[model samples]
Target: MKRAEVLVALGLLVVALVVLSQAIHLGPGWGEDGPRAGFFPFWLAVVLGVSSLWVLVQALRAPGGAGARPFFPVGGRRLVLTVFLPMAGAIALLEVVGFYIASLIYLVIYIRLTGRQGWPLTLAVGVLFPLITFFIFERWFLILLPKGLFGERLLPF
Candidate 1:
């Protein structure tokens, strides 16, 4: 577990450094219009780098460093896979069915199977969630979300 934590922290630190470098190239300062393109990314990367560094230091400095503790206890891997597989499927479905439809399908399956909820509540959430998201993002915000191949034809507005 300690080894895993250290490795993950190091990996994240590297990713943060890479993003920070790119952000610097893009200009992290504010311009006449407003904040530059890299402002948010730069700040976020700095935060991530600092947090990861702290984690790495803690993991290294802990007593009995590199302890023999298992990364996951019994049944933990199964629980993780149950959630992870569905999310991965949803991400895979994004380009094909678009965000709203994919999220609806993902939520319905996840809520029904993993959560073991009643059909009424599951169905209600499955249908209404997407509709609400559509209204919020598309109608109110005027932000165009990917409609996918069939979504463009299926959606009336």
Candidate 2:
């Protein structure tokens, strides 16, 4: 358990560090009017990285030796695969259909299948969430998001 915990902590630390670096590159500083796009996330990444480092240190300094058990127990495979496959598909779809459409489809499928929700709520979330996101990010913030091939054909503005 100790070894596994240490390894996981190390992995998290590395990931947090990478995110922090990217966030810094994205412009972590505040502007004249307000914070830059990356400022909040950059600080969050810093906190995450520091916390991960602390976890790693604790894991390494623990008194007992590493545990014998495996990271994932039996029957965990299905759960892992269920989430992994959808996320992988969504990432692939991101390039093809862009974030909004891909996210809409992903949310609908996940909610309908895994959550076992009714049509009304599922449809509402599937449609409205991305639509609201489009308005908030594109229209209000003026942050032009990635519009894939279909967006070129369908969306005029």
Candidate 3:
């Protein structure tokens, strides 16, 4: 567990550093128009780097030390896969069916199977959630979301 934590922290730190470098190249300061392209990324990378560093330090100083404990308890892998596999499938479906449809499918399956909720509640959430998200992002915010391979033909929006 300690080893895993340390490794993950280090990996995140590396990613943070890479982003920070890119942010610097892209100009992390504010311009006349407002914040530069890299402003938000720069701060986000800094925060990630600092947080990861803290985690790495804590992991190194942990009582049991690296590799002294199991990364996951009994049945942990199964538990993790139950959630992860579905989400991964959703991501894979995104490009094919679009965000709204993929999310609706994912939410329905996740809520129904993992949460063991009644059909009414699951169906309500599955359908309404995507519709609400569509309105919020497409109409209110005027931000275009992916509409899949069929695009507007799929939703007519």
Candidate 4:
């Protein structure tokens, strides 16, 4: 578990670094009117990097972390798949349903089915995210996102 944790953290660190590198080109600073193109993504990368670093630290601190241990525990593959498959489905749904709705559905499934969270937390996460994202990106930044099948009729934004 420790070894696996370290490897996963390292992988996330690499990804975060790569994202941060690309985001720098996109511009991470604030512009005259609002945030630059890369502002959010860059910060996201930073958070990912920080969290990964923390996981790496924990893994390294664990006893015999460097010792031989199978990368995946017995049920690790199932856990990975459980999380991954929904994300894959969400990605597919994004094109058909657009970002907000697709993400909401994905969050609902992930929070409720996978996380086994209560309705309050599930609904809060599922609903608030899209609403906040819409306001932040669409209203504040005046950036238009994809309007899929249900977007035109159902959504006012």
Clashes of each: 0, 1, 0, 0
Model 1, span 8-125: residue lDDT tens: 9999999999999999999999988999999999999999999999999999986654456778887899999998899899988877888888889999999999999999999999
Q: Is candidate 2 or candidate 4 better by lDDT?
A: 4
The candidate 4 region of ten consecutive residues with least summed lDDT is: 64-73
Candidate 2 residue pairs that clash: 1-67
lDDT of each: 0.91, 0.85, 0.91, 0.89
RMSD of each: 6.0, 8.8, 6.2, 10.8
Determine the C-alpha RMSD for candidate 4 after optimal superposition of all C-alphas: 10.8
The 10 consecutive residues of candidate 2 with the worst lDDT sum are 63-72
Q: What TM-score goes with each of the models?
A: 0.60, 0.55, 0.59, 0.53
- What C-alpha lDDT, on a 0 to 100 scale, does residue 54 get in candidate 4? 94
In model 1, the clashing pairs are none
Model 3 residue 36 CA deviation in Å = 22
- Which stretches of model 3 miss by more than 4 angstroms? 2-67
Top candidate on TM-score is 1
lDDT for residue 49 in candidate 2, whole number 0-100:
88
